[model samples]
Target: MDRVHLNPPPAADVAERADAHSVAPLLNCLLREAAAPHGGSRDADGRAPDDGRRVYRLRGSGRLLRVLGERRPAEPEMYVSDAWQRIGHAELVKLVADELRRHTGLSNHELPAEIIDSRNALAALLTARARATAPDDLYLRSEQSLLTGHPFHPAPKARGGGPVATWLPYAPEAHARFPLTLLGLREDTVVEEGDTSALDALGEAPPGYRLLPAHPWQLDLVGRELADAFADGRLVRLGTTGFDTWPTAAIRTLYAPERDLFVKFSLDVRITNDIRRLWRHDLLKLRRTDTATAAALAAIDGPAAWLGDRGYRTADFAFEELAVLVRDGLRGRVLPGATPLLAAGLVEGFEGSPLPGAQDPAAWWEAYLAQVVPPALAAFADHGVVLEAHLQNTLVAVGTDGMPVQALFRDAEGVKLLPDVSRAAGWERLVYCLVVNHLVEIAGALAAHHPTLNPWPAVRRELARHDLPEIPALLSSPTLPGKTNLLLRWTGADGADARYLPLPNPLAG
Candidate 1:
């Protein structure tokens, strides 16, 4: 609707905006994973459609579809009853299920509900945004500014189809901030790795216990499971934190600017592709992955930094359920006089976002490419560390003039160690996350705002400078792997298992 630069529109417009927001990503997934360009590739003008209105064949049903916009496609219509009829979120979900079932020879009873739930969630977020005051701090506003997340997922905002009142108070999109639920875990049952001393500063514990700060929403979701721990001596309820922590774009992660710390908590709710929980497998390997990523970012010669996971602490009885990861705050790593903003927010746009109105588009884009691309490439090439350099995992810090000065990457849970997987597999994963998922979205957003800018040439030049052998082949690959989230959900594949189909490589142009 807008550049994500303003609050939710007037009372009259929330549903329409919400519908548009919800429809864009669903259409994006269908077009990328299930639909093919129908008729001819070009419009009647005999040129590529700069306006994102294009028709597609639903591959499975061979039905014709039209949608507006490219980066975040919207305004879907199905050619039905001898006419193109516009469809709402519900109709779109039904059509998507039918097409996916026909194409994949599978059925997902749960996914359609998720698609609708995502739409409902957006309506709630938009309503909440209309009432709530956005944070004055640029970074906080950026962190809370994703109206539509995961530009190419079917149901990115679904929250287990839960009631809005239950989750809205904790949603990042609503500019939510609240005190953490403080609990004391008995010293005997406090399973911890690395230094989690930062948690101790948030609250106090009695003689026999260790302090643990938890997301209040997560506590609400798992109170029944944790009753035994609280009833017995294993866990004791201390009061809530005296200060509030703002939820970052990753809903479970809360940033306490007072202490300059971020604590990532476990949520059993499924958001996007996976249940956003601190599973035992990922938690156990957290240290090793965080270590490698930290070392790689340290060696990379630039302002680029890694927000390392300091450690984790939880009750041994409910380890995965209650675990909390303490992470390094931005005070130290972020360059002085620079404001760190979520890279995804840059694409989604915020009130003060520079991407939309960059005065020197070429210089702005080149500086962005220079800061973001080098560290990710270096991490893969020099250290065998493939950081999940996707948009959500990255933060680009800008100086006073709103020019990018540094890039910081996080989420060690998503990192892939090279030798653990084959070199080929590792490279593929790196390319998908870094190039397809991260840079392409950013470039699209930038180009949409500044049409004259050809974002890919700068990307190509940046890659050509990299020393890695894979860079040469990457530059010439005709297509890049575009993840098939829609098909993955329809086929009931493991959330961790990524399936890919090719999308034309923009850089190869």
Candidate 2:
């Protein structure tokens, strides 16, 4: 395996580039929802006025601002001391904090800290990525390639305030691979649901015990909390797995290539919005959600597949704290010979992304929509299973020519059931996840890479082919719901409680 440089650049260059990558997304969110652009002129290319630079006033504070870069804002400059001054990452954080405070009429100290932490994490990732080795498997490289994650989230890279050393080794961005910590739980104390038979193949437990595999990083974070369980004879350490597992974009889920399995653990730390723990409420409903989604996908008439969550196992005493989910790996679920790549990575860009090198941007965009959109819609209309089909939860499998051939969706925990919420509510969630969060990002990336291409007409055509009742309204609606991650975090709302603001709908002709 060839090792890529994961070392920091010259100190000055590292800080400057890292700041641009980190603050761009934060500025994007602020400008989109909370600030108003003014005195902007279009360039000769007509991409955006002033070479994608614009002046704006914060809606709440009415403070003047100037920034370069569109889609993802960069090189932010704030009007201070009667002139436009370039702001570093720290200053950018302060600007966001001030703007958000005035916008919401609420003050939050923690969010600013997280914004700073996220930027710091980006710096570390940039340095480490320069020195890290990309996996030989293109699929794995795509899965691990997200350096600037959730391009719209203010603090997407914050790792619950942990030191860089503690989280860097486990970060997918850092190209990390490590063995799982295996444990044996007394049979009487083992609580499991669904078919967790695959776990038995990882390692054998002594008689009267069941094998449990844990993420080493999670173990370190919660070690002291679990000392009593270890001492009480309920849990016994059985050493780490012989084979190493690679972390995916979602840090807590590990892919074990040897066994062809995915094990999702409950990490008590907050990654983006909520603590990444498999909460007791969600764990209790996992089986039902997974079953519904699995059945829904089974009924879809295309190559789209659902990677079912087979089952979960946890200690009775520490249910949420110790729960581990077993998910179906790619071998059986993914199309044979088709390479599956993370959709998020495709949008974020990786070495093998079909998006950039696409021979026909129109055809490629259409194929992508063909694979990703139909199943998600079918699952909802036919089986009432609302898949969280956002970029991260979706995978686009490409053929030898690097054109999208199939779509595979995962993470049953994020699936929502029908009637549990009104049809109207479910449709809103679907539109936001499928269109706003997933497709729009991909379309933007495609257009940015290939300027002559207009990705939306194809998107409109694809949606028109579908007969869902929501299609008509979706096409004509002037605005689409854009989830307010910055505000959501600032207000300390439940992460699952998605609140969306209206965003101009590109599909509206």
Candidate 3:
């Protein structure tokens, strides 16, 4: 398949010659320059940008260039002298194409006017480049150092599908749930084995902990001791069930014999479909939005207290794998717990209840926003954290009274904060997760139950009257959640006694 890559505006020699101007063209130029080279500097190889691409500032030019992968046109002295042009934007574009040509052995060329002007085309190119450059290798690292929800890390030796393992902390309530930060690991230093004694020579087991190997189908590698103990009767047992995300495996055993608890593992390749199932939900939700980019930008976290209040834990993370873990966990595990909240418990049919999808849209909206939303907003503020508050990622755990009791948030990997930066920025993703993904769901529910809220102009007027936070200003400010959801149920809904209310989206108005 044909793929595209964008280059930043080239050196003065190149930009002085073109006639067009726009951020898109500037980004294209920057990418090209970064792919080039730096003449003389200690950090000359040019570091990749936080978003995973090399951004190069030209030595003598005000323009910049960002290069990704090895697919540039191979003709040297490549300049857009005739058919194309550059744009002037707030972000300075750097140039390092000289370095890129040296690395990829590909020459540069000016894209046709049509390609250069189309935002969708440029975006598609960037996406293709990212995919082409993805490394197929992985390794082990501190889970704490990793982003809250990554699938794998770039390990030096743990590549090409060898024996895998994970030192996951045990959670009694959920299969994949673990402590906020700590995990159990083997005490020995051996990463590989050579002889029969290799099995027996495994690292010393930690006190009150065991090692379970990652059967080919498991998520993380487990400790050996824990696996064996689970086989025998030495470890106390917890319930075992097949995970939808990791269907190829079984929870061989989860034991809590006396001190501390441990989980055992085994795999069945058939389970890989779990990831597909979860991904389907993510894509479905993503497809429902027309303003995804804007929505994502609005959800970044800003404070520690806000994060803590909302039950979020912020820390340095491995960017690439975190989102995978969180997304999968949310759709396949956490949200299912809130099933009873819907009227008649009907997902696809039967619509006679008074909830969001029921007959009282206005009442539902007033009641929901009035009671349920505040707590979630405050919880995040108290902890100084930004959560992926998208609808599919959140759960409104309702009680028997048909009122919301607790807001169960899943996908820990998607949590982020303002004033904090990682390989991936927290702001945009935070917004997308919350407002884009979640707010839309809430709006839909309200529309179904409260039609008055759907009028765009009126809703905007009411929102203004409500004194909602200024989204544009807030986008740049470091902020936190201002309320919390303590899993409390609501009552006084005509005829309904008490039930769990849907947790208000933290990013919504």
How does each model score on lDDT?
0.88, 0.88, 0.28
Clashing pairs in 2: 4-131, 5-130, 5-131, 6-128, 6-130, 6-131, 6-132, 7-131, 41-49, 42-49
Strongest candidate by TM-score = 2
Candidate 2 per-residue lDDT, tens place, 1-509, comes to 43565454787777877788888788878887788766453322333443557778788888777777678877877767766678878887888888888888999999999988988888888788878888999889888988889987889889988899999999999899999999999999999998999988888898989999988888898889889989988889999889999999999999998899999999988888889999888888988999899889988899889898999999998888888999999998888889999999988898877887899999999999999999999999988889999999999999999999999999998999998988899999999999998999999999989999988899999899989999999999999999988888999999899999899899996
lDDT of 3 by residue, 1-509 (tens): 11222553334523322212223233333332232344322122443334333334443342343333222211112224321132232122112233334434543431222223222222322233223321111100111111111111001011112222222222111122321212222323222211112112223334653322222223333234246433543332322222311110112222221212222232321111111111222322332221222233234232111111111111112111111111111222222333322211211112222254434455444444443344334434443445555542344443333444334443332345444443134444444444433444456544544556662333333333432344443333343221111100011122111122122232233
- Which scores better on lDDT, 2 or 3? 2
Can you give the TM-score per candidate against the true fold? 0.96, 0.96, 0.31
Q: What lDDT is obtained when candidate 3 is compared to the true structure?
A: 0.28
List the candidate 3 regions with Cα displacement exceeding 4 Å.
Answer: 1-186, 189-216, 219-357, 375-383, 399-406, 421-430, 445-469, 472-509
RMSD of each: 2.7, 2.4, 20.1
> What is the descending TM-score order?
2, 1, 3
Sliding window of 10 residues with minimal summed lDDT for model 2: 41-50
